[model samples]
Target: MKLNLTTGIIPSLNVSAGLLGFFFVKTWTKFLEKTGWLKQPFTRQENTVIQTCVVASSGIAFSGGFGSYLFGMSSVVANQETNFTDALNVKNPQPAWMIGFLFVVSFIGLFSVVPLRKIMIIDFRLTYPSGTATAHLINSFHTPEGAKVAKKQVKTLGKFFSFSFLWGFFQWFFTAGNNCGFTAFPTFGLQAFNKSFYFDFSATFVGVGMICPHIINVSVLVGSILSWGIMWPLIGNKAGVWYSASLPSSSLSGLQGYKVFISIAMILGDGLYNFVKVLSRTIISLSQEIRIKRKDVLPVADQNLPASPLPSYDDERRTKLFLKDQIPIWFALGGYVTIAILAIIIVPLFFPPLKWYYILVIYIVAPVLAFCNAYGCGLTDWSLASTYGTLAIFTIGAWAGASNGGVLAGLAACGVMMNIVSTASDLSQDFKTGYLTLASPRSMFVSQVIGTAMGCLISPCVFWIFYKAFPDLGLPGSQYPAPYATVFRSMAMLGVEGFSSLPSHCLQFCYGFFFASILINAIRDSVGKKWAQYFPLPMAMAIPFYIGSYFGIDMCVGSLILFVWQKLNRAKADAFGPAVASGLICGDGIWTLPSSVLALAKVNPPICMKFLDSATNARVDAFLLGS
Candidate 1:
């Protein structure tokens, strides 16, 4: 059973909701400040309820959106069929209560912040300040004059976001209007590919995935070296052995079985590795907890060698020792460990759960993975790490055993989930930072959640809508098989059937994992110190080349723009760049939703097709004749 919905609908609703919420919160915060009900952070106090709400909301929203993106990207890149998208339609294409159910769940999730805040930050001191954006927003409220200036800046950002939303919408409209369009002069189309040349490091996707220039340069070269430089030529001579004599009749029906298998293996392997890592660390950390007092996972005291001889396990000690010389590493380590455990136990029980270990693993291991992910990728935003952690737990829990295949399916789920969650967590941290320093938590929370939920719901709906919108030509259908979904289908293939055999493609990911691990480690070591210690090439490989390229492009452009702005007018850039980025993100929600809806509605195929043809034709004309 498959749910038939358009991707655009979710985004449209999210954007609309986010705008309203953001505006409402902003207005309320201002009114509260003016009436002396609340004093701003920069003005005096260290914290306030309103400020906390703003920052926390940012964290939640960012986590939700980025989390969904990571899961969707995993499915998209792996070309998998199963994911959050498919989950909605599992056994019920048009579930009578899905939208209503989701709305209820989301609404319940909202109140979670107020109570959770007291426990997480006030009691546990978790430093869940991944809401760096919110922190920044709070920072803006220092003085009356500064507040006015910041408010004006927010308005400006809001307008810029509007423009971005319009641009994204127009772009989507044009692209969706046709499957592929050719420009006579440039000979390019939105969906064009190079079949003759299998290796293209220069593709827009590779850049967009945030493949650092250096890594992209190396990875593509290596993959090409394997596939093109060596394997393709070998296959040319042994084509009969490698492929069937006759090509398959249906492109849609001809699933890329091997690709799906590899994707599952990657997910499983990563997930397992992370699960082990997190469980071990938390078990050791929680030696004090009554549940684990009988067993000993921690290192025996005094029996161990000096900390300097081996790797130092003490986080604070490592930090202080590296930076100043005052605080002992144990001080930071103890607090960090306590908070990690508390967060682990608390989160999944959004309503209390019977099993504490599950929540502990989700909370503790998830965030560490997120932190590692951000540092590994050079994203360097804590918010991203936190959000990534949250997503990792959810995705892995939901899909690990069901979707990932081959040996150690559970392990694979843990590993893949950890990495994905970590990345999402880091992004959330960035969002929080954006709001904390400038905006109120209430505003940030509402907008962020709306955006995230929108992304999550729309991605799957969009694909389905596209399939319906454009009836398969039966030549080469646009409805590519969902990669992860295929992996889930392959779980049965691992059975004891005589024909069953280990998936050959699964080895590629292991190869990728080992190869990337070694390569990144080497790069870090070459830099002398551990400054480059956390690179996550293995995780990057789990993602597809296109998404990786997109991330790379996104990071490069963003970092470069920030660098330039900082150099030219540090004050203005610092004051307003975040707002600009926020606006851009919000705008994406606005434009993407409606356009995707149009694509999904199955309104009129021939008419829509004609519109697409005209749009493409016009573009070609412009390119060729010079518009």
Candidate 2:
């Protein structure tokens, strides 16, 4: 629920919630061992299976996009648009249909990448950082010496978890009304707070900061400063000049237009740059590999030696097991075709705007794109699934045209494309983990399938809870504003309506940022790593342009804490930092369940801890005294 809400609001900060699940599993297994409840010791390979399953299941939450593509279809977004017609509005899918849609579409991607696992993991040697890290973590837990470190890490996790949960509970008491509590605290005075510059005391983001690289957090902070601190205020001064003065603040023709479009511009710019870069790298690398393989002869010394040096015993053993139970190429191909056919037939029953032909076309082209996404994820540990999804929105939405419910068609298409591309990359990453841990390929595949099935049911139910509990969800200024929903919806609208939909000067700003983002990427690449490492990511910066800097501030605080900890003791910080951060995130996240229940029950916080300036306080005091 926490991940869904946070990632919905800011898709870029999607952390792996599976790590938290892995922690619980590790702890539980330890407890079971102590109690002599287990017949066999929990092996590292088994731990890998649990991690794979947990990741695959939790991953469904992200692919579902309750906060982005799914939410974009809601009335909340339709109402936000000035020119949105009733004919174009799409009702949110019912929970049952959502489950069905997710179930049917989810597995297609799993099969799509099954054929490439060996090539990606062995031949390309893609890092797949998350998977490799999880493998290492599992290995550590099963070792004697590492057990001592694990105990300390678990203890630290527990301490922080308790504190984080208590902090959330404390904050809840003061959040009786809008702009109430420490969340709305004006750490930098009222003006900066109003600009969304103050920290919201979000433990989730703080934990996220610790987990994410420093560049991401810094990029967000930089983006916030550029947008809220500078660009927004400057744009506001031209409200009547650039657009109608009579327009509401929320109107797309006014300040909101600038915010949405410019952010989109930057996002697209960064995405395009990275996409091209990765594609070029993949093509070049593949060609080089082919060329090398095609060589018919070797030097005399090399020819006399074995074709390849013998792998270490561990590597050879792992390779043997990985290849022992290979999933047949025919099965993968057949399963993909079968699922594609089912999706083409079934999905339209729920979302009629997306024509069967569109699904067919996307499926036909998706495998190649999925491969690209998976390969890119291997090289960079960054999946551009959303980028590919955005491409679908523009291409399909434009093809559909506005008169034919293009908005709904585009969003639906995005769901299909995103799920396929995202799951492909994710599965590949898991394969890498399996390779490292010597887990059987067949077992990993089965776990992923089972996990995916579970996610199909669980993600929608979880989202349904949020949808039912929070009446104001997806609305601007609400807790889960689902920032990407608006951005994506707007992209579809732009595709259908073209530049005419943009407010005056908005297109110009977009053009400027679009090129600026490309330029920034180019410079980041050209510069040496020493300087490039310090550069802010255009994609990261673009997020805060819409959502505000509260989360960014929280992340920076997390980074600060980590920095201090590292300075004190680098080894301990490096070893236990993720555990502590995960604890903080998990504790705060678990609190969401109770909070939602309270909200649904119509129970409000006991106090509205609002802040007031001196004059207002004096006026209130005088009035009370006289009365």
Candidate 1: lDDT of 200?
22
Tell me, by lDDT, which candidate is best: 2
Q: Write the per-residue lDDT of candidate 1 for residues 65-118, one digit (tens) a residue.
A: 222222222323222222222321122222222222222222222322322222
Task: Give the C-alpha miss distance for residue 167 in model 1, angstroms.
Answer: 1.9
lDDT, residue 151, model 2: 70
lDDT tens per residue, model 2, 98-142:
898898889999999999988898776778887787778767767
List runs of model 2 lying over 4 Å from the truth. Answer: 3-37, 296-309, 622-627
Assess the local accuracy of residue 7 in candidate 1 as a C-alpha lDDT between 0 and 100. Answer: 10
lDDT of each: 0.36, 0.84
Q: After superposition, how far is residue 391 of candidate 1 from its true place, in Å?
A: 14
TM-score of each: 0.50, 0.95
Worst 10 residues of 1 by lDDT: 1-10
- Number of residue pairs clashing in candidate 1, backbone atoms closer than 3 angstroms, sequence gap of 3 or more or interchain: 104
